[model samples]
Target: MKMTTHQPEHYNNLQKLCRICGERRNKGRPYHSQTFETQIKEVFGVDISDDRTDVHPKYLCFNCQSQISEPSNKVKEIIPVEWKGHDDDDDCLVCDIKAVVRPESFAVPEKPAPKRRKSEIKITVVKKEAAMKLKELNEHIVCSICSGYIVDATTVTECLHSFCKSCLVKHLQTRQTCPQCKILIHETAPMQYIGTDTKLQDVINKLVPGLMESEIKRRNDFYANRGLSVPLNGNSSRPITPNTQDSEPAKFPPDDGRTWFHTNDLKMSLCIEPVKKELSIPQMPMKFIRCSMKLKVEHLTKYIKQKTLISDEIELTCNKKTLANDVTLENVWLETWKRKEAPMTLFYNKKK
Candidate 1:
């Protein structure tokens, strides 16, 4: 006996069929007994039974619905079977398929690369205090004449007290006593007593910065104020030139031009005598020239050597006594030849 399969009224007029397998249940076969919508709703939790509205319904065949309900082997690999115990039905079969295809979502979200902490650093400083006080410095480097810090420092031989070179020179131009102790430095030529204290100068340079340059500037300013030419060294005192307008009355009347001359400008006769006959004269033995009070005995020996063509091996004597070269001609005249108006004779003796 042949039996006819009963088809639903909805399947007879359906234009759409199962979305997964594209199959319809219109054929008179027993395998097409169930509607595709019912199978899809049971497996994937989607209802496609109603067809009254404009929205199209999606359907899945019984075979495709059965395959979707079971988790895929790929999905099982990423999510363990034990995870089913905690399964929530809200996640649909479409969501399970996405998780199977893209497995990165299930991986333990790479525990956000351990937060790096910066190391704390500390710095230490050590401060040192000055060892000496400002007031205590005065006892060591104070100058007597300026009563300040000594610059271009000089020391007196007679009395051991220090002063600035310029200050001492200016003071000694009029006075012959030490500025600090008032002790006699020299009876005459007070400048001869002052000497440069190199040790003290070095100490001052170390103690005070920029002192030497400032001293040179001050000496330059002193000469600039006086309208005089500054010395090249800037250490020595300026030479004093005699002013004829400020001179005292002449010792003799104006008619005597020879007597009207200053004592320093007076002409004196120098007679050079050679002890040995072998030495020839460079010029005349007797020379009459203007004499300066500042001319020393050494200058006369030099002049005699030039005139008499004698070498430095010759020694000179005045009044049978060996003349000290440092003694000035004016000093020798006052001591020995003040009464003699004739040419002052210098006898030369050859050194053996």
Candidate 2:
């Protein structure tokens, strides 16, 4: 942002108009000696006319001049030049040799522009387990007795050991003992599918695309390796059910204490009948029929051999008939009913 008077020759004009002498001059062509005095005054900033005339009178003037801080001997040995107009061919006004003035502005040092270092941006990621409620299994893990497999099975005992459905059934069929710990178990004891009606099943269903196939198979394989029966590919056991008696009709608790059955109106089916008309063409012997049918028929013929004693050719009347007439259709009936099954309870409450 700094501006420089890089034109040193022009700077001489500025330096000549120092705050010392209070008069304005035309700065036209002055005498050589007077011009040298002016140049010296401009450089030294003071009038110096009293002594020492031969140090090239141009360089000797001094009046209120500041001490030359620069070593005088070190002045660059370049020849002084004559003053000239903007013409390039003119010679120097002093030495009269083809003159060149080294611009002081060129000597002014330049500073390098500042740089911006790029910084790395880091992203931090923290892994946290999703918050989820534990869904109760509709079935037990494996048979408690032999640590064997069960299919579509869930088992829970007072000891909290679960068993596979088939395995538990088999164990109950035999000695009714926990396969794992040899504890006595009862058939009536609470032994329904344990985990169900929980959000975890929905999460599992969402996470695993083929839930019943892949996830269930994986779990079954794990149980099977532990001597447990795996559920079959087709059917699995239902979720938790409260125990109930088969002879007693199942009762549903009421809406506002009384349950009611609702019915839905059935959708009706539609049937369409077709009509026909005909017109004869003046240019041709053929007749065309315009009918409600979406298709156009050029001609229709039927051949029938009736009970004729002898062969004979017969012609039928040319009246058009519609086959869709006199049609009978019955209204379809559809019904759906809800049948309540007795709830099966996990805790039959009978001690083994």
Candidate 3:
């Protein structure tokens, strides 16, 4: 009989067929025919049906009955996920979601014994003395760049390696890679990736008492004698303008005597810099220009094309990541390039 949704569950569950196979008898009474198994054994005085026959039927094992049987084996719906706009008529969608199963665990489980009683833990408090030797973390206390005790500790964001702030910054001006791991700090200005490790510095200072104070005093004396503003995290506290340069001015070549154009409008101005040893065809007529923050990458491409008589497409990049033509320069400056320093630097190359 075909089952329907409206069928009474009790009526559907009841079966009065063969005890062995739960099927109807097909042959003559217990002797000449059978519905499923047809084996028969005759005892001393009487005839006996073999196992699985109508007379001597064997029930299914527990596992087989649970798996092969119907409703009793169905997983109960303990958690119903509401599909706001789902249209698919599949009933098994609930099983696909991760960590959403609520399987009934009927098997007995062995529990782990607690190491300490909750009452004992809550009531007890012990005084413990802890001491750490400097030699244990000797390398951690020393600056990887200087190979000395860390002074004004700073950490590289990419590799999470700590070093002397001055050593890391000065190293970055020449090379933009981590000294310890050689990971790229940044494509443009690697100095920005360096962060002051205040906690690490504090730990170092405590480990070697008076080191931080002595360093700060020595730094103050040196700067005072030189008649310069005190330094801030290895950099000059005085804000650098276009006309002036950092302490190490002789290292970088001059920007062709280019200076920031004085303007009332607070729009962003950038230095269209070609990388070192790059072709001079890319060198624009004006190295500096005051433009609206809303300038798109396509505008920059067109501008570059006008300056250089070339048919090849130009590609703009910040931190070595290509810029989409539609993205505004301000978005790139704020989100991608992240060159907060005045005269934001952007690198470009011909799309090969």
Candidate 4:
């Protein structure tokens, strides 16, 4: 015998209820498997399966089914970074280093501190004070040659001699030697007159001690030189030109004592110069004088050659530093004899 199929009267009703809950229908998608966690998603919202397995087996959508299971352990928990408050006094948990917990009594930082100014320093500077004392302690000395007080600071003469303007002028007029070193005072013009002032004091303070000693020695040597030894009264008068013979006159021929010379004599006899054989002088070839410029050039060239052939005549003491002013002219003449001769062409070239 064949058996007949049986249909439950509530089948359609159960299907309609499943559609409302968004569960998968047997005719459509399959149901979620029996996993430890699951999510059931519905058009309305998600449904969750509790940790308890005793709950009834229920149809669920994929989204709602996933929500039902215990929340995914894969997702990480996010906590915000929390800054500790000043009052909280909580230690940092991450870094091992300790941060100072400033106290409430501490004052807030204001503007940065100002730098110290050296000029404003109130400390007593011994060196500067000593310098000041030195300046005051120094006494002004009179120049022996000029009889003038040495007041000018920059006006120290070559011999370490110093003097007032009028006195120096008189000294130069009368003497050429230094009042200090006895070395020849070559300079008529003093170094430069500068009375002691702030600027001058600074300069003096900066000068080395040894240089001052040298300066003094130079001046002493100058005053001791022979030229400065002329009598004071004699110095008052005009300086005397140097003479070869103090009292004698130059020699020349007397008028009437010479032997007779005929009128035909090529040389004439005068009272000053008696008849003598005519000297044969070198005569240049007879050439027409051209431009005056050319003649001058030739003369200048010869002069330069003579000058170059001679050397300086002035002599100084071995250790002496300066040339004496009065003796300088004589010294020049002395050196002229040894000077290396220069070509006349040099002078002519210089003119061009």
Best candidate according to lDDT = 3
TM-score of structure candidate 1: 0.34
lDDT by residue (236-305, candidate 1, tens digit) is 2344345533132222123344332243122345555654455353444554554665678788777777
Report the C-alpha lDDT of model 4 over 1-352, residue by residue, as the tens digit: 1111211212222332122132223444544333422223322232334311221233433433333444463233222112221133323211111231322212233788787798976897666444344444334344455443332332343434444433554454445554455566554322122123334434443542444445444543443443332222222112223552212211121133654332211111111110122332122232112121112223423443344332223222211232233433222222322212211111011110
Model 3 per-residue lDDT tens digits across residues 207-271: 99888667766766666566554533233346434555444322111245755343321256777
lDDT per residue (tens digit) for residues 71-157 in model 2? 254344322232333234333221221232434312324788676555554568999997743233222322344543333334344
Every model's TM-score: 0.34, 0.20, 0.33, 0.19
Q: Evaluate model 1: give its lDDT.
A: 0.54
Clash pairs, candidate 3, are: 20-57
RMSD in order of candidates? 23.4, 28.2, 27.2, 30.4
User: Highest TM-score: which candidate?
Assistant: 1
In candidate 4 the C-alpha lDDT for residue 50 amounts to 35
Per-model clash counts, in order, read: 0, 46, 1, 54
